[model samples]
Target: MGKREQAREEAAFMRGDVGVDGAATEEKQDAAEVERGKAREALLRGKAYLGREFLTWLLWRSESGEPVAAFEKTGLSVLFLGRVVLKGISGDVTELSARGAMAPYSEQVRQGMDRGLLVHQARLMLTHGEKAYEVTLDAEFLDIRAAKLPALMSEEDDSRTGERLYLAEQLSAMITTLVEAFIAVRAGRTWSKQVVPAMKEWMRGEEGTRKQTALQRAASARKR
Candidate 1:
């Protein structure tokens, strides 16, 4: 074949129009891309549900007297603070916020859970070493909003800015680590078999545990 004709044929092959094998290669590539797209979509959907479930689990943990959860690797601890917001996932979309010592045990919180409401947001205090950060996290997107970081000890503007940035990044990393850990457990067998049942029991208030605990606290307060 002429050199120009040979070059054209090679280009056509590369374009997957000249041979069966070339066309098959193109088809394989297309299939791989589609698979990748599907995987990406599945990953995103998993993360969304994971976030929601994590929030619900956090609420359960708090009310069940395990509020001081830890990210052991990071030496960070999270305490669900006095404020929590639950939003209905279905029906009329009722929303409720509870505050103070009764927040976790509030009847509204229980009823909301019974009605298929998930924890939409929560206020938490995160402790790392001597510093503490207060942040409100949105469950659906895992967005941190209205965060209050510990004060920087530095007096100079540049130094203070650097310290603030460092603290913020550290807090962000802690939050990410905790969320990823929750997602891992939630996507595993333990979640459906153990965590979900525990959460359902808490929602049902099977033993009137929350109310009894609240009364005990009030009694203790009165004695003191």
Candidate 2:
């Protein structure tokens, strides 16, 4: 079982209400739900690392050309554009930020990883057909602090307002869908068994060869 699942099970067991069928009692279940709700609230408040994990996984998938589990139907592709930030979560608290054309390929990112830093915020570009959306996604609360949506096509004031609202809703929905996809995978066995190992291997780049290899694999995967 993944760490998150194990943690939940252990928490339930600690409540001392396991039934003959090895199921939590109704009261225990209710308590567990309340705990889960609080955990969710904590994450939303940036008191947890789950948001950082999600952003890191998103970047890894984008770099490796792995298809998004939820956005397949939309034919949308996610790219890590310029302006990336990596922050140390423990001990000493270091912060590294990079921008410009070479930001994505900067050596500072790998160096930050070597020092136990994680992707704290990143600029992403999502493209679907002729429409391109650019946004800065924060790992703290999984919030989009800024976004550039496609130009509104409607000319009239009322129509333009409606179009703007529709675009905003669409953007929010897309972010929600992708985040849910990440959570589904993250809570599964495959995350610890497969995805995390690959991510670590990619992060420990030596002389840039490992990064190139990863990019090449991504390019090859895209061809198939």
Candidate 3:
């Protein structure tokens, strides 16, 4: 017999199986429900980000065509959002859901299968598109869960275990890093007067003196 059947037989022999069956069934159901909830939530969050990126790309492409540089920014945004969503869904939904709003994304993720879609790959396509910018971030974000596997001991319960807590902290750090990356990349691509030159002044310092000299020369001509 399989291990589960063997265990059930042993429990029945001890007279505990019949008595505990109801509780056991409830617990299993609860776990499944929780997992479904988490998957759904993650799915929604991922779709939201993916939707935004797709719409942005479509609009930009229609208007100006895709800028070669924009590929990196678009890809990175999708990657970062995907990572957060995956991290939100990594463990038991009960464990992660108890933490906060990130649980909703997990819930939406669970509903994906019912829609005849594979959550993981669809998430990747939304973020990556067709190019080098394709879904590099998507791959990295999904890896967060695998990276966390070793730390989540099977013998331990989620309530008593440190894994879930540690995962939350790691996810938070990743979000912060990605936000910074997004700002830097978008700023570079848009070349906004404030963002681009300000970043250069921050990074290169005093090199903008050449631009400043040219501005002065233009002013002098207007005076003459």
- As for lDDT, the candidate ahead, 1 or 3, is 1
Tens-place lDDT per residue, model 1, 137-160, is 886677888798887899999999
Clashing pairs in 1: none
Q: TM-score order of candidates, best first?
A: 2, 1, 3
Stretches off by above 4 angstroms in model 2 are 1-42, 91-93, 206-224
Error of 3 at 132 (Å): 21
Best prediction by lDDT:
2
Q: List the residue pairs that clash in candidate 2.
A: none
The lDDT per prediction is 0.67, 0.69, 0.33
lDDT at 84, model 2: 87
Error of 1 at 195 (Å): 0.6
Q: Tell me the deviation in Å of residue 18 in model 2.
A: 17
Per-residue lDDT of candidate 3, residues 18-81 (tens digit): 4544343223446445644544455345654432332222212221122322333443222111
| lDDT of model 1, residue 126 | 68
lDDT of 2 by residue, 63-137 (tens): 644445445376556767668888775767578888864465456675676677888888876666566677898
Off by over 4 Å in 3: 1-151, 158-160, 189-224
